[model samples]
Target chain A: MSESTAQNAGKLSDDTVPSALMDGEFLQQLRQQMYRFSLLQLDDPQLAEDAVQEALLGALRNARTFGGRAALKTWVFAILKNKIADTLRQRHRFVDADQLLRSDAEEDIVDTLFKESGHWHRQERPAHWENPESAIRDKHFWRIFEACLEHLPARQAKVFMMREFIELESHEICAAAEISVTNLNVILHRARLRLRECLENNWFIREG
Target chain B: MKKCRDITRLLSEAQERELTPSERISVKLHTLICSGCRNFGSQVDILRRISRAYVRGAADEPQREEDSGD
Candidate 1:
């Protein structure tokens, strides 16, 4: 055990976990953050609460085994992410028929950005974004990005998050969302278009 | 014959799967003339990168507070 602990510690970027992780107030804050993160992805309060509870319990049970390798928050979130995935998989199997239809019935945003001739709308054309790479390191940029993500229609945001943030394969997302490959592509296409437009309007263009 | 709208869909689809030769060719040809489609392609790529960065940064929030305090 000590051998493995030393090896893990060596492999990690941070050798020690901060004491703040142990503070009661900090733990409470972490719990709230986890709930918000899960809710954003899961979009169901009950499931989000259950996922957070299970993750926290698992973290507590495995606390000694944590070995001061990764940040406690990161470790907890890793567990929470797994919990959310499992919950999604389970829910996917029993997804309500009405919910599935509703998700499919939602109107597409693509039509608004394109003319009847399938060309870009004059006012909707994408503007040149200078140095978008530099925005990744800016905290304010992330805030705007998150807001833009939140602005996405629920189904679009959920599918987009599963693909991009959770790093799930397209097939996996299709299976989870009960969407066909073609349908998945359309949803992703719409999501990207809107997201690009939102960030361009809110951040990049505003900066210029 | 592909318009900017069709080219943008192909661009986004490329993220999910391999585009067929003709589809790829159409996108390549269309984007060459259409600055708007070209910009859309790069912006979507940026969206993917930003998403990954966001995931990594999510857990760093509290840590950032601690670092500033120290």
Candidate 2:
């Protein structure tokens, strides 16, 4: 090597070593965040615990190659997210969306709506809209809300939890969910709209 | 400044604290002018708060698994 290039290479090893990349505190925070995140996704405490264990070990084993582009949490979560996605993908055994939607052509969503809750706009506007103290006092309101959230489609539910509950960035969510930014936005939008409609019809309107 | 529809669109972004300064200003201006949009924004904020609360509650609940016919 040239003398100057050789000198710079020697300084690189002195200045920074890749072996010193791992930060124990950073990894612990990553583990906690991933645990909370996985809990929201799986809705099962046992599954979340198992997932966090796997993610922590994965991060530990791969720490040497970590490039440190994003925040440590983001990097670890990116790995953990892939693990969660793979688990979900294995569990998913359903017909394609288009085929399911097409074959259920006779299943009128309007009829389903009518049976579930009538004339959504015709119902009285909720007073709880102004004061959530009443909503907090009413356990039944939350019970229905939880049911609606649980009934949401899997991908929509995942995106909603990642963004709304975990407060993860949209880019991170898009990366974790293996979806395009546009699709992630669409999923979140639909999830919120459905949640709003469901809550309005079931708790807000019915209570009124 | 954002219009009412734009303000509503930003509601989710705002809840996640993802809105840029300019976007926040746009939504702020729209909400200031439109009562309907303000009410809509309030409801969205409430929804976000409740979501977080519910998640916390779920995390704290005793671990129990029932085969609810999944």
Candidate 3:
């Protein structure tokens, strides 16, 4: 048997077969998701489109060597993430003045969680999350997590994603989001607090 | 005494930058007595781990199989 056939025979299933890469609707949905993710990071529609196009092209060009160890979506996202990082680095010099001036309109969720004396509000105290590590292995837990992430205010969600998901440095995020270091910290703090509370309410407490 | 509010912010900032010696001591002391803030700190750390796992496509794995439409 040829090399490709031999490789297929060793696999448990055909999900990773190169032919699976040709699913038109699947590819289209992947492209849209990539574009949405890129847009969230880049914040410019044109740049996001170009980054997705480039990433998809790069994925296709290297499709032959895709060993199927990772799901194709994961592989594609890895490529798009690199593409976004490159775009962010290159566009650093042209900081949009408008972004800097955008109002911090999102009400501070952190403030409400605390009180006048800086104590946790009685009702807002974070309860213990039992065996959170195990929740990582539970697929339903992630859906709740994503829902909480989605509920964050747009600015908070963007800054939080850049810090936690993209793993951007503080300086890189400040530059990209056109915000001060202090502002970034506050946004991250609020995001974390909100996400923590959200997961506590929606998942941990519910599960308990 | 450092309030849980400030202690939690310090914990979050700890993720981004090194805390001052005084800030570190304050957090250590506060969380020692405060269960809520203590839980907050670990939850945020778990948030970081979950975010990393999500990016690595942990959450997408099952969805991918469903999308295969065999």
Instruction: Name the regions of candidate 1 deviating beyond 4 angstroms.
Output: A1-18, A57-71, A93-108, B58-70
lDDT for residue A136 in candidate 2, whole number 0-100:
50
Name the 10 consecutive residues with the lowest summed lDDT in model 1 chain A: A9-18
Instruction: Candidate 1: give the clashing pairs.
Output: none
> Residue by residue across B1-70, what tens digits does model 1's lDDT show?
9888889999998888899999999998988888899999898888888887676654255336445442
Off by over 4 Å in 2: A1-49, A52-128, A205-208, B1-4, B17-22, B58-70
Q: Sort all candidates by DockQ, best to worst.
A: 3, 1, 2
True lDDT of residue B66, candidate 3: 58
Predicted complexes: DockQ each: 0.48, 0.09, 0.49
Q: What is the lDDT of residue A150 in candidate 2?
A: 78
Candidate RMSDs in Å, in order, are: 6.4, 13.2, 6.8
Ranking of all candidate structures by their TM-score, best first: 3, 1, 2
Compared with the true structure, what per-residue lDDT tens digits does model 2 show for residues A1-208? 2344335444444224333224455445556767867876765677677666666555545444423413334445666666665554444332346533542332343123222332223232222364565665466767788788877766567678767655667666655556667666556655665676677667766653
Clashing pairs in 2: none
Query: Model 2, range B1-70, lDDT digits (tens) per residue?
Result: 4444455557755655578888878878866766655666677777787875554443222221221111
> Model 3, A105-173: lDDT tens per residue?
454546888888999999899998889778877889888988998888777888888888778899988
Badly placed stretches (over 4 Å) of model 3 are: A1-17, A64-70, A92-108, B63-70
Q: Say which candidate scores most in TM-score.
A: 3
